[model samples]
Target: MSGSTFALRVAQGVGFTGAAWLSGNIAALSANSVPAIISSVREDNISPNVACKQWRNMYEAGKTQNPPIAFATASSFAYVAWSVRQIPRSLAASAAYGGFGMYVAAAVLTLSIVPYTVAAMRPTNNALLELAESKGDRVTSSAEVEGLLGRWTTLNWARSLLPLAGGFAGIAAALL
Candidate 1:
């Protein structure tokens, strides 16, 4: 009935979709890319160069979906930003305000990771991207690629937690 109620619903929807996209990205990395990299490194059946190429190929393919996913994630934040202002300052008796608070927390929590990711992970990501796009010899050796990917995957896990939490929080907010 209220604007906050509507906003919470929007946040819930957007957050869930965004979270699902993010999870898929993680799942692909976990299920496919990471294992492939490990297999490439340890086993003689797959050469390091071949594996690196596969990894780079897959990495580039995966990146194509990022823009839409990023937009979806930002949409959730937008809903929260719009809705929170509708909530009153006096939170003593308002359930709607409480719910909005959770929604805001969801956005804030998720957004908090962005800066760290941009600042910390950007260079490594750029390097990998360049490798992915490169047609000739890789800039780094296979061992280094493996290390970089391992670090990226580890950081990705950390990055994933926030939107997941935000999605759940948004759901709770909507229900409340």
Candidate 2:
């Protein structure tokens, strides 16, 4: 048993499982809501400014939140635990060991979203925030915000897909 402390294994399990659930939820939530934004504007002819404003507010609020805190914390702990000692392993424990590796991969991949967001999306995000703050509800029609929103929508998919992968990895870990 490679001195696989019960506590370390448990923490790894939590980290990977939490990553799966949290990342999956974040990805699903983003995907589900994006269509609604587009639909509401096209179907109802709602103002783009209003939509942008809503999105800006949501982004601002979400920025302060940590949806992946559980995954992060657990993963961090698991990493630390592993640094001290690799989780004990054997062919019999392949399911768990493999799953743990996947979870770690998930964490690594999920973190990759930061660079894309910072490089590609942050500019547009900042502009949208400023526009919403300065213009508020007065801007009429959706055309004004289309390009930024479009870019945002597209880049967001990149951010979301990794977590989805992590989530599936977590599921594998949990089952195996």
Candidate 3:
């Protein structure tokens, strides 16, 4: 096989794996980790301050980890699309063009979570971070912390869908 063929295969593999990994990581946080933190506060097992601080720690960790995954996944998808584009149309069938489209879409969708977070989720994140920094003193009651946490969870759930969609697109491309 040619170098371009090898690169295309590598890009496809990286894009699919990275997209799935990022999506699963986000979903795990949304489904299990965040809820457990909120549950601790709700059950009074931990003070709201402690819960917020714990949440902040998790959020910070994700901030460090997730962006790189997203970017790498998107870059891989973009590279796959570029590689697909390099194939001569006479040799590349209609399915190859379709895969190229899907790869491009995958790249866009995978990267979209970053802007989505900035636009849709930043306010809640900022508020939560503030509360965490204040040791929960900024809020009137534990309920407020719970509300923010719930909102964050909901937003995160939505955010998780972007990479999931990208992964699905990647799968669709591979099938094509």
Give the candidates in order of TM-score, highest first: 3, 1, 2
Candidate 3 local lDDT, residue 11 = 88
Best of the two (2, 3) by TM-score:
3
lDDT by residue (tens digit), candidate 3, 1-176: 98878888898899999998898999899899988998887786687778888999999999899998999999999999888777777655888899899999999999898999999999999988887788334553678888999999999999999998998998898898
Task: For residue 12, give model 2's deviation from the true position in Å.
Answer: 2.9
Question: 153, model 2: CA deviation in Å?
Answer: 1.9
Candidate 1 structure, TM-score to reference? 0.69
Better of 1 and 3 by lDDT: 3
For candidate 1, write residues 1-176 as lDDT tens digits: 88767766666677777865675675567566777677767775555555556766766665576545755675786677566657666644366776767777766655555665688768777766666666666445767777777777777677667667766776676666
The regions of model 3 sitting more than 4 angstroms off are: 135-139
My TM-score estimates for the predictions, one after another, are 0.69, 0.67, 0.93
Local accuracy by lDDT, each model = 0.67, 0.61, 0.88
TM-score of 3: 0.93
Q: Model 1 lDDT vs. the true structure?
A: 0.67
Q: Which stretches of candidate 1 lie over 4 Å from their true place?
A: 1-11, 84-94, 111-116, 130-141
Question: Candidate 3 at residue 25, lDDT?
Answer: 94
